[model samples]
Target: MPAIVGIAQVVSVGSSGVFHIGDVFTINPISTAKTFAGAGSFITGRGISVYNESSLTYTVDDEVMDQGINFNL
Candidate 1:
């Protein structure tokens, strides 16, 4: 089962931590997590040093993980 949310809760990552949305912006390690907000839930993730999506011609401006990873669906 999955949960639903509205877009009204979509807030920017302002907290400081490894699992926080803001931390991923700078550290870019590579991982994946269950993204949620007033707009519901989403499986968010990003690539890492071992995996580069950019080189594959896939541009990911926003990533939920600090490294190369994906939230299992």
Candidate 2:
């Protein structure tokens, strides 16, 4: 069974862009750029937009892993 072990909130610096459920984003270094999850980049968690806010902020679920990687989801 899958459960939410952790939660994260990301804020957009330049443009909030479009985000959807299951959209993954990087957490480390804390970036607001909209970079796709499996796009040869480090991923921290999966996006979980619950409400429609205008502050350019998003909620994500932390990914479970034994070790962190530099790229890839």
Candidate 3:
């Protein structure tokens, strides 16, 4: 299980398409790409679909530490 530490406003370079509850995500700050979290990826948080409004933007419940770590989704 993952801890919900805080809320975050994540946005991709462009439209992120539709997001659903429990969707895994990671942030690529360099490219500003908010893509799905995968093996060995640093998991940022899970999706809260109700707040997903635009294709490029969405909200999430953060689970990573301030220092960051690799967590697979």
Candidate 4:
């Protein structure tokens, strides 16, 4: 099967409905995610009870991989 590409939207200002660089996201449950800025892109992050703000932190999820979403990089 060819790799599937996904896309997300910038939901809010303080917190992103879809996580991106310089965005904050707190995950309570196991949820799938993708990149917001670029379609079929990816980022790295962890499941945290409370997501602290970062300059360019990304939430690592498996909504669409091979784009750049990977942990322990």
Candidate 5:
């Protein structure tokens, strides 16, 4: 058994990615991501003084994912 391809177009590919035309025995892909954010208000110093009052703001995130993929033929 065989395959015949006339035309093929590819846009983009990310990390740990693969592209094949003929055949493959085994394929494995892995990816990871991380993000951080901060929000606050401060008005104080050792040698400096602040006369104005400020509000406080806080933010938190608690979601994480660890995954993997494997393909074999």
Candidate 6:
């Protein structure tokens, strides 16, 4: 189906965020965050080391029907 939005307002959209008003087949959002805190707060002194690693995979279908949209005054 479809929808008619008379008025739409979006104040803010942060990282990995989305704001939609019309029809959508799929909306996917992925995010990853890493934080390191030490005695010096992410400050490494002599004879110190840090290591970080991450892996991610995502997939989505490309088959979707046409969704109509209309706006009214």
Best by TM-score: 6
> Model 4: residues >4 Å from true position, as ranges?
1-5, 15-18, 21-73
- Over 11-66, each residue of candidate 6 has an lDDT whose tens digit, in order, gives 89998777888889876555544443434345657987655454333334364843
| TM-score of each candidate structure, all chains considered together | 0.15, 0.16, 0.16, 0.15, 0.35, 0.39
lDDT of 3 at 20: 38
Itemize residue pairs with steric clashes in candidate 2: none
Candidates sorted by lDDT, descending order?
6, 5, 3, 4, 2, 1
Q: 1-73 in candidate 1: lDDT tens per residue?
A: 3445454554564343233332232454244454333321233567423433443333444856455434321
Candidate 4, residue 7: lDDT: 69
The C-alpha stretches of model 3 lying farther than 4 A from their native spots are 13-73
Q: What is candidate 5's lDDT per residue for 3-69, written digit by digit as tens?
A: 8978989898766568778666666556445444323234346676445465443335454743533
On the 0 to 100 scale, the lDDT of residue 10 in model 1 is 43
Choose 2 or 6, whichever is better by TM-score: 6
What is the Cα-based TM-score of model 1?
0.15
Q: What tens digits encode model 2's per-residue C-alpha lDDT throughout 5-68?
A: 4565667643434533354554343223333343323535678334434434334637564343
Best-matching candidate per lDDT: 6
User: lDDT at 55 for candidate 3?
Assistant: 44
**Candidate 2 lDDT score relative to the true structure:** 0.43
lDDT of 4: 0.44
Q: Write the per-residue lDDT of candidate 4 for residues 1-73, one digit (tens) a residue.
A: 3454476566575432434444344534233454445322344567524343544445566655454323422
Provide the clashing-pair count of each candidate structure: 11, 0, 1, 1, 0, 0
